[model samples]
Target: MLGARGGWQALRGCASLPRAQPAVRLRVREALGAREPAGEVKVQGWVRSVRSQKEVLFLHINDGSSLENLQVVADPSLENRDLTFGSAVEVQGKLVKSPHKMQNMELKAETIRVVGPCDTWSFPLKMKERHPLEYVRQFPHLRCRNNMLGSLLRIRSEATAAIHSFFQDNGYVHIHTPIITSNDCEGAGELFQIEVSWVEKLPETHFFNVPAFLTVSGQLHLEVMAGAFTHVFTFGPTFRAENSQSRRHLAEFYMVEAELSFTESLQDVMQVMEDLFKTATNTVLSKCPRDVELFHKYIAPAQKDRLEQVLKNKFVTISYNEAVEILKQASQTFTFKPEWGCDLQTEHEKYLVKHCGEVPVFVINYPYDLKPFYMRDNEDGPQHTVAAVDLLVPGIGELCGGSLREERLPFLKSRLQRLGLADAYEWYLDLRKFGSVPHGGFGMGFERYLQYILGVDNIKDVIPFPRFPHSCIL
Candidate 1:
């Protein structure tokens, strides 16, 4: 029987057979990392590559958990067909440095243990065949095994954790907001309506007395919490049925929202956004170095250096009027010319940000007609009531959307009445009626932010399970 150390010794001594070696142990990753021949290593992982050389079988194995894979040279006399591609196995081998970089390390196996067998017909992942995103999305279970999807998912996880940590360290209370809400916070009228079926003797309503729609944002709810907590935030999945197939929009996506009470000005909101973006990007860069490297190398080659540029450069802030002016000046490419009152289209947003280089730029003070009714009116400005700021990135525009809310009950009520939303927001007005403060918050599109940070094109690539305008793939 091979001891664990002896098993590793067998793998290391594979290039030249170790004399009279007992049992050995090796993991697929450790065999891949085997640079020294003095010590023994044991590794276990899925089969990544296989080649038959007469009597010996040279196999490359990877454990989906990491980017590294181990090289195993097994004698065909052991009848190791059970360790085929996608199969899990344990190998005891001696670690030896490889002459070539492709197979940087080598393992000579004494005993190979089969852990589990992958279905030949069902296992779609293989070294020879790499599937596209559309086909991979069809197989959700195996999608993570692919290099691009795996790195993107890993970055998503890291970014999520970083977002939470950034909020926690910055004296913000993490609020878990409700998913079902009666209010349409954005007031865009693109809601996915919720209804229930009742076949037996019906009530007059089709919704089974539950007049609820999926929450488009947690901003209002976080405001309630911010009243008590001073600084509060919510990270949750929000639903939007806008039917927009844009590269930045998703029907169901995560949002990072933070509402701060007693902010001095819009500058405070910009500060929070800049700090949060930096923290998220730096955290992912540090924690998921390998993933970041892969993204920098393959998916987004330009973004690797751009990440640092965004971090080091000071973020620029401009008014909606100024952005419109710049857009109009650069209107050669835009189909819809930028007007004073018109909303900044995604194309215009991207063009302006590209002008600002890789740094994030805040487009503030949008026109009253272009924004929601909740934003505070600029007292010193002309007719622009929207006290909003949208954080624009280089490749992806509008990563974060936020505003200083109208805190005064009278102004809010008057705006609601003018917009014909008083009836819809009766409860929202109540917050202002009871006890209101100078509260402001912003909503960051989680996938949009991820796409910007990761340099990905389609928003679908950033989300693990994406729900688009017409897609609800399992």
Candidate 2:
């Protein structure tokens, strides 16, 4: 439709258009360990330290991509007078080899511009001093600027990705379970109820027509999905109204739960949990070696060998009766005496793991009365045990808990009636009535896993924002 002269003009105009410029900025992690020298580059990060001499000024910058900060050597004439600690700045320079023993490459700055000015006297973090984690925890909003917390956050992110990859690669469908649920999975009765209000209210009215609470576990919901999908998992926030201020408990935390259908054997559930732990730990160790090293050297020195032992050895498996015998014959004094039907305490779990060479061990087939109503009955006469499994590690006891579900309708109804919870779970009984397969699932506390891996003493230090009994700051 166009003439030759017009077509030629349009082509010339298109040729004259400007192309998009390529990005020139490199992260501090890349800038510090660049294999080849880059002629000209741009870097942006927060200044960790500023050392000024008469001729040259040395600026250490970090962007949280790595544990190490990149050193920038700038001339005195580059207008770096305001480059104090914690100041955000953009640096334009050439990447070159550094003579310093700490790092490999340094940025030779031609121009330095301040993006945000920081007052050194008012900043909470000191330049060259290491602050205690407890002290830095007070400033929840700014603690990410510190090296330890920053490294921890990076490792957490990597671990999350590794977990997702593991599940996805193994044909597991990620199910986003409901956060607000009507049923309590644990049956511990420690639930936080949801309250709602309206400007124009009726005499007796509530949101859901009944009562609701934040979910304590996603295992029940994952089981619902597992009836349709072969393998399903959920990783999300779970809440509990626990009043204790123990370092091991959190009012709000994350849980990783998985359910598998057509699984009658308890070994299937234990095998999946073991593989997940080993795979995720291996991935974190390979990807975050430096961050793990930081935690090993500073946070927990003894945890390194323990974690290695867990990865190398096959997890030991034992029955609950065997564990009870061991505890009864042990020399260690316990607060609670070993009984046949009692639940294993943290001390007992730790002793069991230690008895098995300080590696992870699975204690299976617990007493039927100790578990919830959903667990399948093993029907062992006089002993009366359920097909339940709990994985205990050395540093942290009871890392994971799971059980084979009761697929028979009559048995489930009878068990629920005995527990006085039959009326509250009619829909659950329907799952058994209308074509239910043999299913099982497990729940792993995400914060506890982080604490186990990072060797952090308190669970609060591992999470970004901790919610416990009396504290919910920021």
Candidate 3:
């Protein structure tokens, strides 16, 4: 049942796949590392541990198949005996009872099959202990050599797949937003500019002819497509030039952005965000129990518990003013002092989540100057700006950010004018004038969520081939 996908009907007459050959096989973990198995069995894996004593050799082998590895005992008398660490080999032997306590069962190898022998000079990773920081730098190649790292990457992949599947099943159209753009969506002055020499040869007159920058967020472009399609989302790389070398910051990161059209209010956008977050957390927990266990033991138990709590509890919603008031009264330890008009720093965000038991908190009604022009104007308070929501979680500062878009052309135009961004967003202004309906959406940093779920400390570790301030390793 575990091997086949479509049950008995799909494999009715398929002779190629035998009933004995399951879709996936599980190795006997008890037969690991100098442990003799109870009977005869076939063992296979990469060499993990090897200890030789004159005539006999003991081997601890791993297949990267599971957390547990297999042990093979090799004799020096073998005709073609050649093997080392990182070598690929297969062992045929009798599964006998184990005398060694390290592994439950041991394999009495009758024959050895060496697929490939790893050259001693070429293998850089030794069995000796390696420092964490140095290992991360030298770890690009040998990371998969360890079981825990492999498990974390496996879980990360599953979570990514779940993200796409969750949106696709909900009838969300996948939109491909441009990475290079003319307008800055966040207005935070963090965009990475893309410059070329096209205008360099044209003298001083054509110096400003070509202008483009890597997009910090795909919200504005996705809004253009959201008006046509009821639900549209973009999953791609977003860049920021800010040189903050914190655990939560990254120069280049993946953003899962969605814009829902014809929305009732900001509440609708928040609800969608809640749904997406819950789905991703639940899917990862359900699918990766082993990886979750490893992450809990080695990384941070608080991160895993925080995600679980978020899935169960009703997310707390508070306005920016309310948050400011709470920060003023709270006794939590925060490095940055929170003020009414000032932006909530990482320390403040972390403190708020911890106060709420580290569950997801929706901070809404931000100051107009803090948020962008696309948000719907909130006319209730003193500041009549667009409605915006930022979902803050434990470990990660702002996991998700969304706002109800301003559908009115005049208000959007005025907001653009006041922000001194009219020239850059003339095309975006066209969306409001041309049959724009009530639309709202949010963008979640995919790597940020992965970092939280996996309990990984740095954002660079979660993303493959990360592009940070000082490093861009292929």
> What are the per-residue Cα lDDT tens digits for candidate 3 across 354-434?
878778899998888777778888877775545889999887889998888888899889978987888778998888788
TM-score of each: 0.85, 0.93, 0.80
Please give the lDDT score for candidate 2. 0.90
Candidate 2 lDDT over residue span 79-167, tens digit each: 55577899999998889988877778999998899999998888899998889889888989999999999989998898898888889
Query: Please, what are the lDDT tens digits per residue for candidate 1 over residues 1-474?
Result: 899999998888798764664545544544555556735556777777678878887877766555656677778765465767778777776777776767777777766787997776667776767566667777766787777787777688879999999999999998899998887889887788776655574555645365688999999899888778899999999999877888778899999999999885888998999999898889988988887787677678888887887788889988887888788788367877878888888788889888777578999988777878888878756664578899988878788898898888888899889988898788888888776788788989888887777777788877888888777877
Model 1 misplaced stretches (Cα beyond 4 Å): 1-45, 54-57, 72-75, 90-115, 119-123, 128-135, 197-203, 206-208
Scanning candidate 3 in windows of ten residues, the lowest lDDT window is: 21-30
Report per-prediction Cα RMSD to one decimal.
6.9, 3.6, 8.0
Q: Candidate 3: deviation at residue 32, Å?
A: 12
Clash pairs (backbone) in predicted model 2: none
Better of 2 and 3 by TM-score: 2
Q: Compared to the true structure, candidate 2 yields what TM-score?
A: 0.93
Reference-based TM-score, model 1: 0.85
State residue 16's C-alpha deviation in candidate 2, in Å.
13
lDDT of each: 0.80, 0.90, 0.78
Off by over 4 Å in 2: 1-23, 79-81, 197-203
Best-matching candidate per lDDT: 2
